[model samples]
Each structure stands twice: as C-alpha cells, then as structure tokens.
Target: MTRRICISGASSGIGARIAVDLAREGHHLTLLARRQNLLDEVAEQARAAGATSVTPLAVDLTVPEQVRPVLEQAGRFDVVVAAAGANAALAADAQTHLKGMAWAAWHWEANFRANVLSAVTLLEGLRELDALAEGASIVLLSSIAAYRGSGSGSYGGSKAALHPYAYDLAAALGPQGIRVNVVAPGYIAETNFFQGQMSEQRHETLVGQTLIGRAGMPDDVSETVRWLTSAGARHVTGQIIQVNGGASLGH
Candidate 1:
C-alpha cells in the first residue's frame, strides 16, 4: 500500500535522503524545510525517484508560529519524520560557550526549540488538524551526543529531554492508535556534521570511538526510520534506536 509521509528538514542531509528513499518505494511525500529552493530541489528529486506525489513546504521550524500553518496545509499523512536541526548540532567550542549561565540558557533554549519544540509543534498541529492517519507512526530525530555526555552540554541536554517526551507521547497517543519513537544517531558524514565545526583531531576521536570504524551516513538513519514506520515495526513503539555504530559504548 502507498503511504503518505510528511518530513521536516527534507531539504538536505538525512531528511532529504529519507524522503527520497521512501519516495523510491512509491510513497507520497510532503517535504518541509526552511529553504524554498532546497525543498523544491528535493521535491523534484522525490518525484523523479517515483514518489506517488510530492509537495514541498518551506518554513522555518524555529519560529513556533510558522509550524502549524504549513503542517495543516500538508493535509493528513500516515507517517511524520521530525528530522529537523541537523545543522544546529553544536558549536566548535561549545564548552567555552557554556561557561556563562546566560550562554548556557541561550544554548538550552536554542537546542530545545530546534530539537524538541519543532517536533512538538508539528505533533500538536497534526493533532489539531486531525492529520495523523489511523495507525500513524511518528519518528523524532535525536543524537548519540544526547545519550553520552561527550559533546556540547546544551545539545545533549536538549536531546535528552526528547526521550521522556517520546515515552510520554507514545503512551498519550497509544489509545488514539498513534506510535512515537526516537532515533539517536552517531557521527554521520552525509549530513556534513563534522565539517568546519569539529576539528580534525576531534573527528578522528569520534571515528575511533565508533566500533564500526567509520561515521554513519544519512541513509543509515533513514533506513532505521523506514523500518519504524513499516508494518514489521507495528509492534515497536516508544523505543530509541541508536545509529551510532557502537559509539555509545565508548562514551
């Protein structure tokens, strides 16, 4: 059966790859992102990849006011992948930035809005719009940094909040037949996560930390998400699947 999937951050990286993968499987895709040009590019590619239908929605997730209107317009969907905030992971010198309480507060708010509230706003809008189709599945993007205290304190803290939120949401939406899950990825190269922001030394450290001896790709996370939304994962919900290649073990 064809699926209607709505994905945020669909302009690039993991989000774009996820949209394309599902589209290639003949799913209808509604792609949302901050950049209109990027979204259009992804949407066109999705159609070329065999998506039954493709709709591009350009909106920034940071501004709470912009979320609902776009999601409302996407209409109903069988799956929602809240994959926003790939680029807002952390600063090169996050430890220094975290020295002051004001900076700490700002970092916390920034990460929270980007990583948590963005998904929440979309969920709330879907609820209000009655847009989540029956047996709908929701996937929220998280990170291995959020699991172990090895990266930006603010970024991890913001992502940590998502675990409890997902658990509660799974229970809250269960009676309504909706399932919520979280995915925490390790060092992913396809998203250009380490470019310019992380030093080469730090990059080597992260790579060595991964048992797989390499960084993950956008497709790594996308495949995990695809499974969660598939019929095979119907029994799976409120779980966190780490795509870190065993990096968490070292952490």
Candidate 2:
C-alpha cells in the first residue's frame, strides 16, 4: 500500500536513511530540514529509490513560525516521522561546569524545543489537515537516554520527557483512528549527534554493551520505525520501540 509520509531531519542520519528506505518501499515523501541543498539531495535520492512524490522543504524547525508554515504546506501524510534533534555534552571541569550552567540551559531548552515540542507542534498541524486519512500513524524519534538520567543532563532529561508525552499522545489519538509511537535509539553511527565529542574509549564502551557487539546503524532504527508505522503494527500504539542492539538491557 503506497502512502504519503512526512519526515523531519531528512537531510541526514537516521531520518535520511528512513526517507530513502520508505521511498524504496513505494511511499511518497515530503522531506523537511534546515539545509535546502541537503534536503534537495536527500529528496533526489528518495525519488531515485522509488518515491512516488518527493518534496523537499528547508526550514529551521526551532522557529515556530518557520516550522508551522512548512508543516502546513506539507499537508497530511499516512505517517509522520519527527526525527530532528540536537545534543551537547556539558564539560566536567569546575570552571567549565559553572560556565556550562548557561550553556546547558540553552541546550536543554533547545532540545525540548527541537526534540519534544516540535513534534507536538507538527502533530497539531497534521490534525488541522482535512486531507489526513483515517488510521494514520506518527513515529516520534526519541532516545534510549529517555530511559535513564545518566547521560548529558539536558539531552537525557528532554528525551526522558518524550516517553510520557508519546504515551499520552498515543492514548489520546488511538481512539481517533490515529496511532502514535516512539522509537528510542542508542549510539547510532554516522550521525553528527555526538558532534565529535565522544572519545574512542567511550565509543568502544558503548559498543561493548550492545548484545550485537557493535554500535547501531541508522538503518537499524529506521527499519523499526517503518515497521511501527505499517499496518502490521496497527495494534501496537503507545509503545516505545527500542533499537539499541540490546544496549541498556532492554531499557
């Protein structure tokens, strides 16, 4: 069944991979990101991969006015993947720690704005679309950090907040013939997520915890997201599908 889908963060990483994979599955796509060039490139790739319709939208999602219009223009999709995100690690030293208070605050607010609030806003926009079909699905891109409070302060907290929000969204929309779920991924490679801050030792330690003996790939998360949006998962709303290669012992 071919369906129209809208994806955020489609310029790179897991979102980009998902866009391509969905296109290959015969889905139509509306790709949104901050970079016009990158979004266009990804849309081109999606078209080549078999997307029935490919539209690239460039906007800074953190800005409400910018995001709102683009999302409204995107119309309705059978599935919406909210995958845009940003992260930063607060320095551990004392001076840096004090300085990081302000930094963390800004980052925390931004994370909530980008990772959590943006999804909610987009969902609102979707609801306004008369073109939305019944039984539509929404997949929120959360993180395994959402399970605990140990990682970067703001990042972990913002992600953890998403779990409850996703559940609430699912419960609210399920009765309306809409399904909402969260895909929590851990340590995916090839993403600017870490911003080159993770050390080799830290990377190895993360991989060692995974049952698969390697860090997850963008495709790993993307595939699970695809499944959750498919008809096979019609009965699977309000769930957090973790794709961490067994990291954090199923957290």
Give the top-scoring candidate (lDDT): 1
Question: lDDT score, residue 249, model 2?
Answer: 67
Native-structure RMSD, model 2: 2.9
C-alpha TM-scores of all predictions: 0.92, 0.91
What clash pairs does model 1 have?
none
lDDT of 1: 0.84
The residue-by-residue lDDT of candidate 2 on 221-251, one tens digit each, is: 8889988998889899888888888887654
**Native-to-model Cα distance after best TM-score fit, residue 167 in candidate 1, in Å:** 0.8
Model 1 earns a TM-score of 0.92
lDDT of 1 by residue, 40-155 (tens): 99999999999999999888877768987887678898999998874343545344444567666766777788778877888788888889888999999988878775355777
- Which regions in candidate 2 have their CA more than 4 angstroms from the true location? 88-100
Give each model's whole-structure lDDT.
0.84, 0.81
